[model samples]
Target: MSDDDATGDTATKPGDDRGATYASFVAIGDSFTEGLSDLAPDGTFRGWADLVAEHLAALTPGFRYANLAIRGKVLDQVLEEQVPSAVAMGPALISLCAGNNDLLRPNGDPDALAKRLAKGIRELRATGAEVLLFTGVDPRDSPVIRHARGRFATYYLHIRSLADLYGCRLVDLWSMQGLRDWRAWNPDRLHLNETGHRLVAAKVLTALDVPDAGEWHKTWPLPTAPTASRTENARWAREHLLPWLGRRLRGTSSGDGLPPKRPNLTEWP
Candidate 1:
């Protein structure tokens, strides 16, 4: 997965949205983009992309979404395939979440990841979508991911620079939050669980200046100055249960006092 080499995660069906009258949103990246986790099943963009979409539906009047996320996709693959799609859609907003796959895929070359990511950024911006670059937490904290933290940190900062260069908004979850916060991740310790996604989405919505962003903020309050361990499972439970209850009680998925039955793709790799 060199910067020049292209590789992608498992193949997936493009998202389905034929009747949406809302502003189009396109997401590009790897498992994080695809929402790979204990909570998200295969072929779903369960991460912040979905959360953002849900929030936007409430505020934007009528926003649609197109997730170009492919699991295992390196920066190069996204630059080639996903970027073009974003250009075609001319989405109102576009989010780019890459680099993790470059770290995970065999032969993943970190040295050039920044360059490839920047290339993708340039293309996404060309589509006129207000590009949103999401800087997530370091995966190395999990113990299973092997790259050195220093290297990933370097790449992360460089990606931030690219975002600034492109004048795109950045949601630096990594900088704003700590990885030691267990509530930040699901049980799999890889992709973000529902709680993490909500937090990330709220941050992005605020950063992007999206309307009514506060509605997407954390519904569950942290245990008065919560410790990392205490908040971990509690956050997980909130992520799983809150949305379900809200949706069920409301009886509508999107409007008129009903939240869409946005089911979590709670499957595995």
Candidate 2:
């Protein structure tokens, strides 16, 4: 379906609770799935996957969760390192969100990225897990990443297609109007902030036919003043954009030495 066509209601109705159906959930991908920017007090990222898992755990006794996602992981790395382990765990639910790191690379190919993503999804599905996929939020709000808006859109379209082909539930972030707001993003203008992650968790649950408090897409209160002024934009470029570009040029990644937060399918803390 076209992006516009796909922009109807969320995957499931409001107030529909289906959390009990899932006994376990494993999230795999890059920093986004690893929960960057949505940091915990102990200096760890706890993104939407953890939030969703917490809700699911509350509903089902002995619910297990694992997040095998590491920062800066490309699609190939995810397939090689994380996917196999996630499949071995045999969780009833799996959420995969990768390729943003690849998309940010110079001259990245969306089609090739989509193929890799599809392969991982298919492999996960082979384990009889209900896979969850995501279309990235539009990055146009960021001055730096906005240069590749066209490429990002193409990648998102491919992701939508893959979700359809695999019968995976999709958390269509591309169509979520709330994400377009700059406030939804972290200072790095890459990862989503705490509020943004919360919204994503709600959407993912809704996609899974789970019940939630019913306010994932609510618009933020209007900013009293303009946001992302020239000075702030310049600061962002210096602080976030330049470092990221340096990493890319040096052929390094943020996840260089970082291990997966929850390497095993264990009880949610």
lDDT of 1 by residue, 1-269 (tens): 23233223221222233222336667776667666552545543367777777776665555677776766555766788667767776776778877765564445565578766766776666655577787657655554354556666767777676665667777887754534456667664556777676667777777766666653444344657644465665674576546635654664321232211222221111
Judged by lDDT against the true structure, how good is candidate 1? Answer: 0.61
After superposition, which runs of candidate 2 have C-alpha atoms over 4 Å from their true positions?
A: 1-20
Q: Model 1 misses residue 168 by how many Å? A: 0.7
Model 1, residue 181: distance off in Å is 2.1
TM-score per model over all chains: 0.66, 0.90
Best by TM-score: 2
lDDT of 2 by residue, 49-132 (tens): 888999998778899999999999998999999999999999999898888888888778887787667668778877878888
Per-candidate local distance difference test: 0.61, 0.83
After TM-score superposition, the amount by which residue 144's alpha carbon in candidate 2 deviates from its true location, in angstroms, is: 1.8
